[model samples]
Target: MCDTKHCTKNNNNSRNNNKNNVKFIIREATKQDCPSLKQLIIGLAKYESRSLETLPNIEQLEEYGFADQLAKRLFRTVVAQLDGGDGDNNELIGYALYYRNYTPSQGKGMYMEDLYVDSEYRGCGVGRALVAQVAKQCVDAECTSMEWLCYGWNTSSLDFYKNLGAVDIQESLECHKFGISGDDKLAQLANKTVDQQSIKYKIRTGVRDDCPAVREMILKFTVDVKMNLNKVVTLDQLRDDGFGDDKDSRQYRLLVVQLDDSSELIGFAIYYNDYSLNDGKGLWLDTLYVKPQYRRSGVGRLLMSRVASEAIADRCHTVCWGCYAWNRRAIDFYEQFGAINYSLVYDLRLFAIDGPALKQLADCALQ
Candidate 1:
């Protein structure tokens, strides 16, 4: 039951502890609750020894959370109110915030971003109720797991989470938090003051003719990630999957970067159109790779810029991609473009439905 405090590993359980017959009403938050939520957030900051001035303002929260059009909400929240509970309180006393995340491990996940129960209402099941609701949402979303963070010194909060079965991944994995290091958006990148050598690279759409070169780079890319090349894909298969004229069969697009002088391919990006009913249209960066010799030469940035430009052209709401945990250089590169890294968030679990598993599952379904 958590979102982002640093996206560390999380403990998760699916249980509802409302057996105490609490009188509070917990429901999804709306515009009317913004003020209450804001006040709660400020109180939370002060409790954590921080100040309200450091957080987003009401107008910003409204725009980002409740705006009808062009809303940039990063999380969905639910608030706890009263029906016949303590003092017959109808005021918002507690809230929980969560958001969806994805990583190479956990294909998709939900992170509970914030949860707070009013001081007056503490120990009255309000906090547990909010968390139970968020956990329910985790199941509704079919997320791999739920994750969040807590202050190391907050023993009470830590105990509450431990009771919920959350594991501290930070103890084992080096936790690193990165914010969007660049102030520029996709459209602004091309015009930004950049390396002089960037002008000499050509970013262009890839076609069937480039599949061979693309495949060779794919081999090197796999090896660079320390992943074994289990099987090599032939150029014909690559074309059929990406460049085929049969629009129905083609599922991905490719972009290749080359030196304008020598026309040598140095980097590549493969992507596809992906949509979520909740998020509308988004572009998935499947693979991004640069030749070993091209490292630190700005080729990687050039390829990413073109990929982003294409995403903007398609009106994609966001671009999604993942990098290896050990690939600090690539992570830093992406931060320059405002990519939120969720690698450490939640327990990453990828399910590969292999041939035997597919057969076994199919066998379970009766005709």
Candidate 2:
């Protein structure tokens, strides 16, 4: 609930500084902000030309974001409130919602689920201040990166984020986003029966002992995707993080595909539950990889099917993942299940900051 006040030039700076001055304070959102937050969510949805029908109601929002139960609170939010010196005039102008995520290579990370600034206050640095607050939290939490998605067509926002030291991963990493949403579609996909060829394989939940195989496969997956295996997690850390005594504190869930005859691991999918203002409860598929030899044997789809099945059981609204645009095989496989190519339809691109850039951005926040 700490407040950070910022002053920025308003449209009417020519007037006496004391009269038309525009200042705002950024602070963590509280349960009481849910009503205002819900309205802002609607404004954002309309502005983005997205539907609001599927969004959670205000009560659900309170439960999902500010409930007493840690497991029920899915994300954290920071808001920008107008500060007119007169406390009575304070008005919420914008907010940024985010949640924690983990990357095998980067460890702890943060993903911004939603960011919106009222159209009237667009250029007053509110958005920047809100993001800075989130970035500061990233450093405080020892996270290695902060990531979000932006529509490629929104050049203005692209430049805004670029100025904040973020890089569009679509351009930098050459990856595109995709998602499967709607209960009907998710249910249909969850019911899919993987057509395993004559070669037999079994998909099962990974355990503590599977860390060694999982780590090896993670390296292979990184190389296969032509990405550097920089700062990858160690075997012990992976095992402890995923299979720790506190099950509720696990970072990610695992599903592995094993050869039935040899009991050898051939593929794995790493995913975790996620929540967003737009999608409500959802699942993020962090990494899904199949050994080269097992590529066409339906192991990949089996893993995905299992992921989708679990998501549906939990009543998740969406299941999302990213893959390189050049990976037509992967793209085609996902399309078979009615997954929408958000990158293609909405021109969305993933953006991220990590390593030195992230450190620099974090340092930019006021001490």
Clashes of each: 10, 0
Highest TM-score against the true fold, candidate = 2
- lDDT tens per residue, model 1, 1-367: 2322212121321112354333566778998788888898877877877655556666756755667753245457888786543465578888887665432222344556578888977776667667767766665554445666666667788777665555554443434332221224556654434483654777799988888888888888777766546544556667766766776445468899878888688888887655422233556676888888777777787777777778778766556665655778878787777667643442232212222322332222111
lDDT of 2: 0.81
What TM-score do all the candidates reach, one by one? 0.56, 0.90
TM-score of structure candidate 1? 0.56
In candidate 2, what are the lDDT values of residues 151-229, reduced to their tens digit? 8778899999998778888897678889998888888877778677687988899998888999999988778778768
Whole-model Cα lDDT per candidate? 0.62, 0.81
RMSD of each: 10.1, 4.2
